[model samples]
Target: MSPSVSVTCTSLSFAWPDGVPVLTGLDVAFGPGRTGLVGVNGTGKSTLLRLIAGELAPGDGVVRVTGQVGYLPQNVTLDTALRVDQALGIAAQRAALHAIEAGDASEGHFETVGDDWDVEERALATLGELGLGHVGLDRTVGEVSGGESVLLRLAALLLRRPDVLLLDEPTNNLDLYARRRLYAAVTAWPGVLVVVSHDRELLELVDRIADLRSGGITWYGGGFSAYQEALAVEQDAAERMVRVAGADLRRQQRELADAQVKLARRKRYGQKMWENKREPKIVMGARKRAAQESSGKHRILHEEKLAEARERLDEAVEAVRDDDEIRVELPYTAVPPGRGVLTLRDLELAHGARLTGGLDLRGPERVALIGRNGAGKTTLLRTVAGQLAPVSGEATAHVPLRFLPQRLDVLDDELSVVENVARFAPGATGNRIRARLARFLFRGARADRKAGTLSGGERFRAALAALMLAEPAPQLLLLDEPTNNLDMASVRRLTTALESYEGALVVAGHDLPFLRSIGITRWLLMSEGELTETTWEAVADPA
Candidate 1:
């Protein structure tokens, strides 16, 4: 391994217990810089990170690291009973320091606090850097929100100051504020930081992008934008190659046909000559033999040339990527221009978040719901969806509504994608449901796969298909962090799906780019127990 390389995996191969291969004979190295590991979901991105972090054992080959490694997994789950300091992995050190301060300077306490008398201060500072300064060391993990817990875990990792740090989908549950803090931390990272994330903003902070595809890594200089630009250029070249190869193949076919025609004509002429006794027997026989051998050679040469042209065309076509998009029509979901979609009158959600002056959504108005974690955005959406009752006021939907939660629990694990959609559209025939699912990119066997066996992106599509293809044809759609844990392709698929949704939308999420892409006409912010209409500028700046 090169000295510059912080982590190296040589001929790494891994497979699940079910005999599903993820990474096969993959060799890659992460040097001393921030690397954004990105790919479509289930492409072994997380698995690669785990292999480097030593959280998972590779089935074959080896992984080597130069220094201590710290990892924050995709789903961070700290014990609710543990204190903030304990979660930070500094409780024992802090205790020893306290003991030393209280005049019990025992040898064990000294050893525990050796060269780490400032552990507490560093921990607090790390917490502060991650916007967790408000959280005291004594506070239990249960007191913090999910987003805060993610940050807390990150803080613990930062406190370690490891030479190699691995983060998998670190921004999955973070709100805008937390994400910004993480971005800042990533900007200042000094070690080999490998982050596996679909967050474009987070990926933008990396020095390079390592795109994992088909068990191999393709290195791209710079961040997500640069990678995208490079991919576009490559795709354009690949398409051109395909076109050129296709033209060559066609030309080859034409030449082969011409050769066969000439051969047939020669055979006819020879046969006529032979029939007319135009030449002596020996001469005719010689001429016939020569013509037959020449014709066979010509046919073989033309066929070989045509086959080579076809092979070239196939190779060129293989270089081009197939990024299939969702194309669906939801005319039934369209709301009239002046139709009343939803109303919240003096609404106080079950979780104490309220709309101070009430809200009335009309027509096909698209609303973006923004808030800090624990601001009750989900609660408000649930109230409007009729899953929760407002504390003292009314929350009503004027049209058929569907709520797609963050968990995507709408799908049953045992049910096939087609079966799940059928459950939603009980009145629709099996063929009809299957046809609609095809629009969501779940054609044929893909639609028949059990929901439990689907990848993250596939599972998301299945759940979305169920909601969008419901029997009543929802006119009011409530999506909670619809982009969460979704790969870039899946996010694009979501955007495409929503482009065809001519209905009122209320989406609660921290993904500003996604919200902007969806054409949010109204931006609402939930903060300090109140909800208020805000401008896009205000939402973006938040000052």
Candidate 2:
């Protein structure tokens, strides 16, 4: 393995085909060690990764790398019919070795198997290292779960052993076990690794943090915790700078006001002296002209000082982060403690997972649905929301409910944010709806942006606004993986917004941090064919 690898971007420029500018004149570099690339959803972390991996070409400038490069994208879709060996890019070599063993003795076979005589053993070991020992090379990809497919894809890349690796949201769809295995692999990687992910635990394993914002990367030593500490210190300093600049501005304004008062008083005195005829007309006129010139010079000096002070204050404010705030109150969403919100009896979902016996949610219980991939959490949430009916049993809701799916399909892409919200609340006046959308960070012209053109974070916020601001006010809220693609700031904002909700919430998500932050009253584990009550510790270390 190479001891050193380097990836550099110089004067990099790129944008979508539609001419939406993302990055311009950006420059950054990665060398040897894992670096966590993080930013808000629309800040182009993924785009930067793609450009480095050669998946997307930059519009201008140069991307230079010293050795072989490999990449794993945010969403991976492989042909299910492919054999494990084929997916791993070793099917032909394996077949060639088999032919040689059967006494074919072909020269082409030897060439194919050339230096990889133990290719089968090495492939098996790679799979084993990734917690996929049961995944046989000859087994078809269709036999494995989505999480296993991710591991298989990684196995293929590991077999090649590229010197530079780029991972974009690699943990997005992975389960706990798979995620642990990946974290282990990242710890052992001996190359330049650049990963873009919102998973805090995954990020904590990095050697450094690369904070990308507004076409620039700010380097932070150590992991996520260290980056946060540094950010806090920086923010405090920025706030202090702002305070100082503001004081200077105020002082300049007061001096200007005082100067204005003195100038006016001096003008009155000169006029009175001129009217008294106490001196020759020429002498008084010359004195008055001299005084007027002196006053004009003083006024210009104070005005320049105040302008400079204002400029300094603006610079200080720009240095501080301007993360959007989400503050919306819905008191009408509250429900009585004894009120029944939802009930499911002998519920066998359409996706084949069963809520065996029964399930019930009363009052404002916030239940966190925890499980592995394909555990039917989404199915169960959909069943209760009336978007999908139970296969055999009844799933009913007694209160007004709203469902936010993983895909956020509730909004119409063709419609603007304002139009979409209006669709959800037909009776709401335009002025009232605009007032509420403002709290969701969609002010005036922003509310007129088409849903299709919104960023991932923006789309989620708009969807949440549509649901929470619906005419009836959802007393029971169902969210399926709502934090899937959101950044840390957005996640915090979502948590804060949910804190104000007084109704029952059933959020089916794998984000444990988010679930806990939302103050879940109960935790339900979905596995096998049953829904079992569990605790936070159990979810943390499920056997």
Candidate 3:
């Protein structure tokens, strides 16, 4: 147990420009060791990180931190021209200068600060520790693979050795080996670690899990496994509470109905007695008084019970909001292969002249092209889509094919959802196009909203709708890293839709759970200028 660094927050709230509130009132404390931020995609995990990083100010409440913090963003784009050593050297020099300016310079500064020589050597040593010793120190960031760049960023951050390390999906693009290496380094880190990731493997290394939902934080001691178990228990409790609330509401309604019936009968009897005039005045007055007393008492009791029932219902509904998992159902419109969809024999793809080896793809087969980042997965997708010519080998696809690239590049940022759909499906009218977009969850005025204003998830959904509207409708679909930004529900829905599709599917993604859920039968693992069919044992069994 190391001495912990503490971060305390009280009554924090944040809202975007669209008046969408992210955090309502969040209060939590972060101490030393690794702490994972876990939740669904839209649950403000990234926003909270930005807030802690001082990149964005909280609209309300206080965020207090003890020491320096190092933040590694999920998107690690870097300058391509600078060598790995140069990239880290700059950061070190900046830190050194800042230290000197702050009057913290010591005899150690003399050994580290001269002529950019000391820091560059130290950078190489740090890179070696991160399992990048083979990487030439002179190699530019852009010349390396995406996974390598991610490692480079990690190396740079590690050199800083701040009090707290904030990592956002650090292993998203890394291969299994790189991912394991990252985990090892995280475990070895001496700082207060707060990692925002959906990877279960990464979460297992954490000391605690923090779930950010509905503008609040729920802390679970222990690791990801413990958090998951606690969430299951909470979900079960929520279900029971929902059932009890519904029952109470129904009982209240029944009592109210019975009271109304009694009142009606009493009125009718009093009217009959008056009309018949067969009873004495005293008896009639006594009957009227009894009726009044009964009616008053019943009305008061009904009101009280109804109020109680309504309060219970509200509480139950609130609990449901916190407990209900996201549910997304993708449209199930599958097109069958008429003759053959695609044919590839001895095909080759590469980055520049570097050969990515030979491969074969036949029609009517769902193919999963998988590998670490920069393994030419996207390049292969482009080749299959006829957007890129293969460096060598024969390739042919007769049927119509639709391609959804890793990024939603097909979307027209200037146009609204309706316009994007209408442009893709020119035969359709505004109403028809809007109706089509609505099926993908863009409804009413939202269909008229500009695509540029939409979130990353919304953009992906809109793009899917557009692709589905192609004339001669595609019999084959190719997706590249489609699940990167999708919420868990969206991922599930997309999987379900693809599962039921009749067309041949070729997907390139690193999401293990998603791949298993969609039922990938075979995999094409891309590596250093080679593609091979590996055993599917790498996939974990679904829980």
Alpha-carbon TM-score of each model against the true structure: 0.97, 0.95, 0.83
Q: Tens-digit lDDT track for model 3 on 406-467?
A: 77889889989888887767877777676656657777998888999887767887887787
Question: What lDDT score is found at residue 499 in candidate 1?
Answer: 98
CA error at residue 119 for candidate 1, angstroms: 0.8
Rank by lDDT (best first): 1, 2, 3
Model 2 regions more than 4 Å off: 1-3, 275-277, 280-286
Model 2: lDDT to the true structure: 0.91
RMSD in angstroms between candidate 3 and the native structure over all alpha carbons: 5.1
Residue 109 local lDDT, model 1: 97
lDDT of 2 at 356: 73
Error of 2 at 495 (Å): 0.9
Candidate 1 lDDT, 386-456, residue by residue in tens? 88878888888899999999999999999999989888889999998888889999998989999999988
User: In candidate 3, residue 135 scores what lDDT?
Assistant: 84
lDDT value for candidate 1? 0.91
Candidate 1 C-alpha error for residue 124, in Å: 0.9
RMSD of 2: 1.8
